[model samples]
Target: MTAKLIHGYEVVIGFETHTQLATQSKIFSRAATAFGAEPNTQACAVDLALPGTLPVMNREAVACAIKLGLALGSHIAPVSIFARKNYFYPDLPKGYQISQFEIPVVQGGEVSFFLGDEKKTVRLVRAHLEEDAGKSLHEDFIGQSGIDLNRAGTPLLEIVTEPDIRSSEEAVAYAKELHKIVTWIGICDGNMQEGSFRCDANVSVRKPGQPLGTRREIKNLNSFKFMQQAIDYEIRWQIEQIEDGHAIQQATVLFDPDTGETRAMRTKEDAADYRYFPDPDLPPLHISEQWVQEERAQMAELPRTMAARFVADYGLPEYDATTLTQSKAMAAYFEAAAKACGQAKLASNWIMGEVSRRLNMAETGIEQAPVTAAQLATLIGRIADGTISNNAAKQVFDALWTGESNDVDAVIESKGLKQMNDSGALEKIIDEVIAANPDNVAQFRAGKDKAFNALVGQIMKASKGKANPTQVNELLRAKLAG
Candidate 1:
């Protein structure tokens, strides 16, 4: 079912994700699959379809496909055929591409993610193994175009999904979840800028309960930000066209990041237009159940499974669990900190809030975080034991980040951030504040919560912001009650 209607139109979206498999060599040849090499250096005889070259299946590519199928809970076809999708392009050296059709390696599955707190699942149609087409590089500086065939035969798994996504947000969430899965399982690097992963969105609109409208496919949405913008623009554009009495046309369009608009590239073609047929040069691909089981045995715990464990073992909220398991490195960091401090919720909060904030500012990944998990756990321990306040912890964190001190206690001592937990000292200060603020105390007794808060602020300020907040609240409530 559709998630919701946007502006009285039911938006339907499907995705086609091209995830380049992480193999050392091209799919059917021995050429290097490394990126940023000199153009055309990676193309081999079979990749170029030289007269006598015959395609050889890459065992590693098939293993990666099986791994993805297992990760997504998709069916692994025992026997799948390879067909030639015939198309003519300057970058296509073979004039045809070898891809799976009719019977794909991975049959059906679903990718589930949270759209805010609401759970959404996008069903999968199939994920097929295919060869990537080369790039057509247009150089305005030289006033010429060149074909870089280095990418021509790189192994790719084209993942397709049902039209279950409703909004651009849902579409992007689905994409991110898929990206995480492929990378988590070591299938794809999920690098959009390098074109290791690419997305094409099919968006359409109709009245509630009406038949699906003709759709336009947006091509080469390499970034999640651009993907959402493209889909949003297309949705608005389609709605505008329909409102003006212009019918939506089924075509392929390109999103120009420069103009923040989508323009028609060409009329979209049907499957029949591709003239697909089983390639005479290649044989049907076959996979064994034993092979699938072997892959399953070696696979890492999935994000969902790890998230569930986090919820159960750590007593974390479902949302927290899901957020923590976004990447393997992040999950490891949280678990290590939680284990060290014996406080799961506090660990989650610090990692997700303070650590994440710093990481975002630095534009770095969790793997690159300067503060070690053990160091964070030590800092949290100080906060828990009333050795420092949360605000003080931030100072220590900043110090740790800048390599000023790796030791949390050393930083706390040097900065004098230790919380004022001495009951005698705090009590004397509270008494003085109470005596000096007679009117405020009277107003607080008259049921003004703000007066009580102001008194608490005075205590903190008098203590030089080192008073333990929890202790202050408890003692002040007792003093007022008496």
Candidate 2:
């Protein structure tokens, strides 16, 4: 229903997210899981399900899953069982996927996220460790499609949340929080474009006191914008069907980006249909308490904790802290720059404005930044200490991107871009500006405040745009008022 409809119907949402572990090798095989490789180039005999091939679990993938569980404040199971989910598809060479069925590695967690002024918590049902299936590419240029087994057997952490969401906004907030957690905990890279992270939303609408409506699963929504849109469309479609006296069907749906609509791909399959059973080829996953403790100790400060610290220590607002701590690399960059400049607010402003702008333009991340945190700190320091005017600092920052010197002091000195901070020298320029602009002085004396700004502009021009702006403004106002 739209926001205008107040029929007392509530929308419930749950999410199942698959986050590919940031490991070099696949979970069940030694095949490389790198993206953009030629089709089937990175596959191994085990990944291809060749005869006499046995699967061995990757230790790093398990550790990464535990790290995520700790970050979510979840209970880590000492032992979890893996089962074979039998399905027949071209991409599934073995006709079954190794996944968690009855006992998962992590369970009963909660994630707190902010929605505007209110902080909401979503309970996580379970986080299971699983292996990803291969991709089925359909290209008309080749007259058919082929399988890319590079993604096959890749380790994936499937995080499932309880149906605590009451609206589309809450669903988006939960997804964003999960994305941040995975990236902050160093488990997943959180690159939606590369398919490293993906979300599937389960949505249903019901009356306030009625039984829950049948839900539909929307699959493979990668971006946050698309996630919100897909949920909204699904909810509206379900509501309309119920109102029109039609029953909601339980099925799997795919979102069409071009039309911004959802279409049913197939009826949702049940666990019994998948024929889930223990795989004889692989042993049960045994996670000891010691292993869990060690991984927890290695867990970095999570985004929420880092955000709180940024607010407490750096005196930043909650919004600013949230933006700064969106990614671990971003938080590190902010902290390093803040330390070097000794002015946290100034560092934040420059990083959020100029640095973020450049990163967005280039479509890159903070880790792949052209300028380092130290370099940005030094540049802001020069501006703060009056070694370079704010305008000149932008120029210096642009020049620093060419892989030359990033030292603001060196750049200013080499380029002769230092600000003119001498008040006595600026006073002479202000006097000349007032004398030349007699009409403006007359207007100022007549109580027109805008006349003084013109005089300030003249002083700035006379200084060749190198005068300290605050010093220039003060001298011009004093001379004009006299």
Candidate 3:
């Protein structure tokens, strides 16, 4: 694939995602990890770093990291250490964050996704375990800011990626695929609105084949839409500056959705600037090979693996197989429908086309769809076995979706949608159509395909759209030749 150039400069992007683990407690404390609590109410002694309170690592957080490592096929380090990242913020009551620097629990992995027809792979640097800082609230108070410590100490897995993304589309695709994996594996809730999954994109643009340019980190992009917007705006801004004979500066920026622009928050800090040192209270985390294997054994089948099985067992196209397995619910729905109807391709088409369209329109997931897999399969079966035409099947599908009827056959019968499959009856209709349209027959013999189509339309109209289209086409050709 050719590199995407923005104003004669190639866009380079990397992502740092903070995935909030689904653990019940904080990473280093027993504070509740639930959202929407009163400010500072959920903060425990350890979370607040009160005197005499020591940090104790949560085992579940470690397990979550291990689960992600296995899912990404990353090397799960048997031993990894935690360090203190010195920082000062209104929300940081501890005056420093506990994070990993020199050693991380989950090391190098890669996320692969498709951007248009091109396959792109974004290499991972490391996914380190860390604690979240509290949020600063300024809306409620007019003259002062408020600190909400409830989110502090929330368990997080900071997944870092190499700068492999060359465009905003690729970056969004990578973010979505990563979100699917973390949620599919049940590690995080994957709710971007509630801050359960947050992404920080580092974007830079440089002349082709030149040294990498300085990067600006866009912080806390909670929505994919905003992530793309932020990157695009940042890329344009940097290019504009460079064109004006100004150098791009490295800094942390925030995207404002209201204005669709990015503003610098602060100068970007390097790892060495963090003053990293091992945490005195917490020991290095250790995992046995047996533990890693146990995690692997209990993990659900990965999406890629399931996609391969769909291609091999169901004979679906690669794109269809990959799309069907996008979410676990959708995959199960497709499998059930395919098995019931014994028409894998038809089922795949319906699910990917009509079913997906309706679901998206209603803003609902497959699990919440009004039409059940069995019901859809029954509809497909009718169409497959000549009980209904494709158009008629859609009528039945609408009736089923709107609760007009539950039984596929009942809907077809009530709507009088059953196809006219009798050979003699269809022959009579075709004979009448051909006899009535001698001009069309003459034109058809003169090599006009439209004339042939007109004859078929006449037959369908005579039968009130009940004639099976395939049978009509076959009988018309036979009669035309005779």
RMSD, model 2, all Cα superposed?
Answer: 4.8
Per-residue lDDT over 320-416 for candidate 3, one digit per residue giving the tens place of the 0 to 100 score: 8878988999999999999999999999999999999989999999999888999999999999999899999888888888888888898998889
The total number of steric clashes, by the backbone 3 Å criterion, in model 1 comes to: 0
- The better-scoring model by lDDT among 2 and 3 is 3
TM-score of each: 0.95, 0.77, 0.96
Which residue pairs overlap in candidate 1's backbone?
none
Candidate 2, residue 346: the lDDT equals 89
Give the residue spans of candidate 3 off by over 4 A. Answer: none
Indicate the worst ten consecutive residues by lDDT in candidate 2: 1-10
Report the alpha-carbon TM-score of model 3 versus the true structure.
0.96
Of the candidates shown, which would achieve the greatest lDDT relative to the real structure? 1
Tens-digit lDDT track for model 1 on 1-482? 44577779999999999999999999999999999999998998899999999999999999999999998999999999999999899999989999988889999999988888888888999999999999999999999999999999999999999998889998999999999999999999999999999999999999988999999999999999999999999999999999999998899999999999999999999999999999898888899999999999999999999999999999999888998999999999999999999989999998889899999999999999999999999999999999999999999999999999899999999999999999999999999999999999999999999999999999999999999999999999999999
- The most accurate candidate by TM-score is 3
Per-residue C-alpha lDDT of model 2 across residues 1-482, encoded as one tens digit per residue: 23223245688788899999999999988888888998889889998889999999999999998888888889998888999999999998788999999999999899887787677889999999999999998999878988888888999999999988888888889899888888878888899989999999999888876777788999999999998898888888888888899988899999987888999999999889999998898787899989988987877788878999999999998878887887878999999999988989988998888989999998898899888889888888888888888789888888887767767677788888988988788778888888799999999999998987888888788899988988887777776666
